[model samples]
Target: MQRLFGFMCLVLIATAVPASAQERLKVVASFSILGDFVRNVGGDRVSVTTLVGPEGDAHVYSPTPADAKKIADAKLIFINGLGFEGWLPRLVQSSGSKATVVTATTYITPLKLGSHADPHAWQTVVNAKTYINNIRVALSAAAPADAEVFKSNAEAYRAKLDALEGEIGQFIGQIPSHRRKLITNHEAFGYFAKEYGFEFIAPVGVSTEAEPSARDIAAIITQIKKAKIPAIFLENLSDPRLIKRIAAETGAKVGGTLYSDSLTDEKGDAPTYIDMVRHNIRTLRTALEGVTMRG
Candidate 1:
């Protein structure tokens, strides 16, 4: 009887462990990039549900009822903030999620595009470090027990980012200043251009959903002709026809695809943040370095 009672007590003690301890922390990231950050920092402690998956544009994303359910179940929701997700507020209201909302781009100084703040600070690896730190802090707050693990992970990731920054600087230095200018579908690379000395002209503004007028295209073509810009690249999230039309009209070579707003799947060229940055700079260098600078 004593042996049976002792066995029953052991079973009861094993089952007494809290459910929170057994399950991972539930998090909802607004987009793919933010999702990547959370995954890196949160590591095994978190289970993230990204609203806008790989190659999906958050600027024009229409949140669904399923997305609401995800938010409803999340302990924390990470957003890029800075007017990045215009549709998020309504979705949050509809979902009625009591989750703590954390902005990943909290400390970084934002670059302004006319009246609006540019939300693509992640374009620069230096700013990416800031984002990682923010995620680390937020995760620590939410799960105080795992604070040390979060800090160690963040530090390791920041070291990798530092190395990437050095590599990009060396590569960009080799390209001549005159060959530094290029064009894209949208103004997503402002932070990148500012961080590294490059000139980027785009037909559409910061947001992908904005339609450019005929006059805007004409003006861009005129500028391209005047400057003798060598190449124009297509964004993964943008329509290729617009870039192709511009390239055809201006006689500028269609360089290659650039991953701006979102990342690609694991099978694709740019699955991770580091891969995306390397692919972009490699594409740019290949296009710009070989071309003869004109006018």
Candidate 2:
């Protein structure tokens, strides 16, 4: 009888330990990029649900009933919030989620494209640091028990970001100023261009959902010819046809497909935020280097 009681107690303890270890903060990130940030900061302490998955465009994303259920179940919801997720407010309201909503882009100065704020602030490494910091604060506040863990994780991630920034600067510096121009499918690279000293021209506006008018395409073609821009890029989330059209008209080569607003799936080249930035810069370097060699 004594032996049987001891065995039962051991089994109960074993089951309880796993349950406690498995308990994690429930969080939802509006997109994959932000989801990466949360996972880095939250580490094993969070279970993150991303509404917009890998290679998915958030600008035109339609939330479903399943998405609403995820939102309702989340303890916290993170958004990019420089008007990036236009559909977020309605979705949150409809779901009636009591979860705390945190805007990861808060406190950073945003680059403006005319009257609209350019929401792709994370394109720049400096802005990305701010985003990580914001996410750290949100996670810390949500789970004070793991605040130290979040802080440590954020610091480590920031160091990586610092290194990435240095890499980008050094790489872009190698390209001659005249050869630093880029023509992409959309104006998603404004923040990147502003930070890296490149002139990025696009046919469509900030949002990918915005259709490029005939005049817009004509204007970009004219700019490409007048500026003698050497390389044009296709965005992963955009229609390559428009960029191909522009490239054909201007005789400018299509550099490569850039991961703009979303990350590639797990098995693809850009599986993480750091990988995405590195891949883009590497792609840019290769194409721009070719143009310089030709020139």
Every candidate's lDDT: 0.86, 0.87
lDDT of 1 by residue, 201-293 (tens): 874333345656667677778878888888776453256787778888988877877888898999998888998998888888778876432
Candidate 2 lDDT, 1-295, residue by residue in tens = 9999999999998887742287799999999999999999998889999999998989889999999999999999999998999999999999999999999999989889779999999998899999999999999999998899999999999999989988888778888998888777667889888778899876433334566676877877888899899887745325678777887899887797788788888899898999999888888888888633221
Q: Could you tell me which residue pairs clash in candidate 1?
A: none
The regions of model 2 sitting more than 4 angstroms off are 1-20, 204-221, 234-251, 291-295
User: What's the TM-score of each model vs. the native?
Assistant: 0.85, 0.86
What is candidate 1's CA lDDT for residue 202?
A: 71
Candidate 1 CA-lDDT value:
0.86
RMSD vs true structure, all candidates: 4.7, 4.0
Tell me the number of clashing residue pairs for each predicted model. 0, 0
